[model samples]
Target: MEREIFPWIGASRGTSILISKKKSFHYTDVIANNSSRYIIVSGIPQHRKITLINIYAPNSGQLVGDPILLGGDMNLVNNPLLDRSSRPLPADAALSTALDELQRLLRVTDVW
Candidate 1:
């Protein structure tokens, strides 16, 4: 995952790229894609650290200003009518409402 990642980015003739905690972003989720899977996150070096969130899981309310490619599995059911579940739970209007509110807050729309 590290080979030829940033062919366009490089240090100046006399400048060197400094790698450190402040120059990168890190995140992890256990229930999204696996029981436990570690993911390496990073941002543009020399810039402020960026925070990334797993929107589908909603671990944090902080939304990325850029378009977020949210993809995950948290076993959450916002719409029983459209979303599938192994054991269907009673549909709650409040849950649906909350989901709508979340989508609006994030300015994100479902693909389907």
Candidate 2:
């Protein structure tokens, strides 16, 4: 059941945006009543490629930055409740931490 539903959902979301193991890629473009964004992922067989994500973060506005990325709609800006570890945290803590780290990282031009 999970396998069956997975493919259907993937297809519905236009996840087949690329092909080839040597240079495969996929992206989703979403447009809502007042917002738009993109999610992209690409790779090669033995090398790390690009994963460009565009998301609307609250208050801080549009943030355009580097390759090899993970981003999403962080609903709050300048919140300090997030954890800074490599491992996952509880949902609420993770959200706050992720936003904090993203904001902090964005400030450092050399880090991106």
TM-scores of the candidates in the order shown = 0.33, 0.26
Candidate 1 global lDDT? 0.44
User: Which residue pairs clash within candidate 2?
Assistant: 82-96, 82-97
Q: Using TM-score as the measure, which candidate wins?
A: 1
Query: What would the per-residue lDDT of candidate 1 be over residues 1-112, giving only the tens digit for each residue?
Result: 2222212224321211223443343322212223212222344334555433222222344655645576655345567666764555665556777777887997877775
Write model 2 residue lDDT over 46-86, tens digit each, in one string.
35454443343333333445333553444443333333334
Instruction: For model 2, state the Cα shift of residue 9 in Å.
Output: 30
- The number of the candidate with the highest lDDT is 1
Which stretches of model 1 miss by more than 4 angstroms?
Answer: 1-67, 85-87
